[model samples]
Target chain A: MADPGPDDALFVNEVRGGDQKAFEAFYRRHEAVVYRTALALVRDEMTAEEVVTDTFLRAHAARERLDPARSPVPWLQRIAVNLSLNHLRRRRLGIEALPEVAAWPDEAATVPEAAAERRETTAALARGIERLPAQMRAVVVLRFVHDASLAEIAETLECPVGTVKSRLHNALRLLRDDLRRDFETAQPGTQPLAAPDLGEMGESIG
Target chain B: MTGWPDLARFILGRRAGGDPADECAIHRPRLAELVDERALGGTQADDAATTAALDHLWACAECQHEIADLLLVVAGLQRLGGTVNRLEPPPGGWRRLSRRLAAPRPRGALRLRVAGLVVVPILAALLVAPALVRDLGTSAAGAVDAATRDAATVAVPVAVTHAAALQRAFDIGDGAQADPAAQAVEVVPRGPLPDGIEPDGSAFLPGVAVPPMPAVIPQ
Candidate 1:
């Protein structure tokens, strides 16, 4: 778990008192998680960096309101997620496709096959995740990347658990469809993975 | 969607005394919820829902397929988290962020200066230029002065625009900080970091089981 270190509260307290140096300390601690989380959703390196800056900026700007008793990571996560979604929405104005990292799996790991199989599932993520709608994508990232539960995802996205569940459900369904299509495309003559038009299994069907 | 309790109640009812043939129809709608519960390790209390879902899972190929798909999606997400865990944020992030932090806060002074400098000239031009135009009766000087006032009137908006922007920056500070509710709520512990899951976060999610295999596989 990311503790933000024991002095996190101290830094947050100092930050609330208008300490720039302390705010820097706070930003340094959380930047990686926030950046990677944003990257998982926004899929662009620079935009993910922008999201981190915005998250900390928002955190710093709102620093005086920071609760010294709480961990600031979730708050930071909330801001990063919001900024990522905003970037995604604004990027959609240009209707851009997701860029691939393509540099993954450079060295083979020596983990067990179960671990390896899990990696295979995630190997499909960067591609399949690109096809998800921004909201659903946010839910997916919060669940897996941030390791947040449905309720935590709801809080991060500021929606109800039901909405989280629904988005996650549809997001998974869409990802499954994309995966199936990809798997079928690889095969010689399979009838496109036979569970016809699971698109209707979207929330409308639920 | 048929919410958990309603669906669970129906499923439980069907399991108790309902027809066997209708299992798929009764259970299919809530398949997503069932999958989420299992994948997330049934965080919510079960109304014997997990048992009922599992019982249904072994008997139904379509349900098995759907559940398998959802679990794979969850596992994919879990793995995505692990993959991203290996990455570091670009170097000197704090340097760029510190630069952002050093940016000047929205002081009302710029707007004040804009109002004082621009508004004064604009008012002076508007008030004096008309007299010049009226008194001089189309003289070149008056015409020039009146044209200047027209330009000044158009220019007044620059201050107003800046004023609006500065106000928004202020609102971002005041309005967003109003509730202070975000961090106050406790994030439920994620349980434990599962295998293949790195403790990448400073204290991100430190909870729960590894992604599980689906109860039954579809042919």
Candidate 2:
């Protein structure tokens, strides 16, 4: 809670030496962020927890490879995100459905009406995101949710910053248009407009 | 002068918490005011700003509403971050792993004890049985050889007695030839004789003739 301090580096170094207490210290320090990041991607508490566990377990196994001189938090977070995405991708294939937005802990969605609206909006957002091409969704998610800088996103996605910006622009436009169409259709007494297909949307955005 | 669209783009591009250039800095507060007035439409109810500069968003109604909407989207995206399940370590997870690592190995002495239980008798039999059997067989064979030697020594007298009796019956006198007297004495008749006559002719005849005998002994 006191921001892990410089002690985290010492603990991580000890963890590399197979120190259980050091490993426990590391787990306690970063579990919340790791869990939150994983939960966002996978939308399931169990899967997110698994991702956190796996990320830590892997970090523990490869502790020697971790730079003891650096902050391990970001490195650990990166592992959790990558693992969570892979899990979501596999789950998506198994269900043959779009990835669902992860639900928050029971306490986060307190009011029933508010919860229901969040769920509906989340579902719509997931479908809209799923409809986007994979690269565009990555840029959008990184830019919007993670608040990653263009360079950081580009680095994460292994693409040029120009490409990241272009994709972000196109993805945001598509999302705005999709949400607008959905909003209109959900309103009373309005004739539903034909939603533009993904290719047409991409072309229009381009 | 830059158009409103260019100004909006430049304002949107401005990094939060970063220092902007002098020309952009002059327009920054006015740009924030315009954004507060026009950009979010009429969705936000209050337009009052607490600070003279653009930093009072936490209390401003218009700013709060816009920020809330962005935060809502951010919150929704944040929900999409990774979901975590709270796992307490499997009960005794560490204890179990520790127990496995700390368990004592079977000592060499214990292994030898087990080997003794399994192998000592087999090894003893291997060492002792062959020697015992060889000793028994050697003693039995020696006894057999002694009995055979005794039998050979006793057989010589019996064989000599048999030879002497054979010589006396033939009346052989220290030679291999048969005795002439013994040859001349006919032990059996050469021809058919009467049934009541004794072939030796010591003469107890019973009314039947004896056959004539030849006097010369055949050469």
Best by lDDT, which number? Answer: 1
Model 2: residues >4 Å from true position, as ranges? A1-4, A95-108, A111-123, A126-167, A188-206, B1-219
Could you give the DockQ of candidate 1? 0.26
lDDT, candidate 1, residue B193?
39
Query: Positional deviation of B182 in candidate 2, in angstroms?
Result: 87
Q: Residues A60-134, candidate 2: write the lDDT tens digits.
A: 668888777876765776677688778767765785344354344342344344555566555566657656765
Instruction: Give candidate 1 regions above 4 Å deviation.
Output: A1-6, A95-123, A188-206, B1-21, B29-31, B43-49, B103-219
Residue by residue across A1-206, what tens digits does model 1's lDDT show? 25556787888889899877777777778888898788888877877888888898788778877888877777788899888887777767766454456433322352345544355445565678877888888887777766777777776778898998888777877888887777666675663333323332232222
Q: What share of the true interface contacts does each candidate keep?
A: 0.55, 0.06
Worst 10 residues of 1 chain A by lDDT: A197-206
iRMSD (1 decimal) for each model = 7.3, 11.5
lDDT per residue (tens digit) for residues B86-194 in model 1: 7788887888878877777544554454446536864665555434434422325222234433343244333332232233234344443322221122222233333
The whole-model C-alpha lDDT of candidate 1 against the native structure comes to 0.63
Worst 10 residues of 2 chain B by lDDT: B36-45
Query: Which docking category, incorrect, acceptable, medium or high, applies to candidate 2?
Result: incorrect
